[model samples]
Target: MAEPVRVRRLTDQEGQRLRQIVRRGSIHAVRYRRAMMLLASGGGNGVPVIAQLVAAGEDTVRDVIHRFNEIGLACLDPRWAGGRPRLL
Candidate 1:
């Protein structure tokens, strides 16, 4: 069977930064959800529960986790290039 997904242990700075994001400011809701997911996973929540908690699908949750694992905290701000070139 496949192993469950989990975030690596966060440094004190990373944990603090995540807490700040979760607590304040007017960041996009997507960032908020992503922060929550990482924080919860770091605290031992699994992908399925994190998905339900954030109202997202399990696959989406897995993707977020994988992104964070691959690129650290930047996963919170996915840079989607602006919508495909408009078909003139």
Candidate 2:
């Protein structure tokens, strides 16, 4: 049997902060934070549960968690730097 994905626990402060974001209904940060909280709380703790809850794909949920873990809140906003500029 394959090992299940380990769910990360959110501190009380983190949980509260995430809840606030969800309540604000920003239509931007809310979705991301909600997913983060769900994942952290072991809600579906897998690709399918997260996808169903957030109406996104498994890959998306996985990416979001990874980005948040890597860069903190900045992950909420996607950054497109565009391709490398050509040096003339």
Candidates in order have lDDT scores of 0.89, 0.60
Q: What TM-score, over all chains together, does every model reach?
A: 0.88, 0.62
Query: How would you encode candidate 1's per-residue C-alpha lDDT over 34-83 as one tens digit per residue?
Result: 99999999999999889999899999988988898889888889687987
User: What are the RMSD figures for all models against the true structure?
Assistant: 2.2, 4.7
Task: Report the poorest 10 consecutive residues by lDDT, candidate 2.
Answer: 35-44
- Return the TM-score for candidate 2, rounded to 2 decimals: 0.62
Error of 2 at 39 (Å): 5.4
Q: Which residue pairs clash in candidate 2?
A: none
Tens-place lDDT per residue, model 2, 1-88, is 9655434565676567666666666577646554454545354456676667677776667777666666655556667589989899
After superposition, the stretches of candidate 2 with alpha carbons farther than 4 Å from their true spots are 27-45, 82-88
Question: Among these predicted structures, which one has the highest lDDT?
Answer: 1
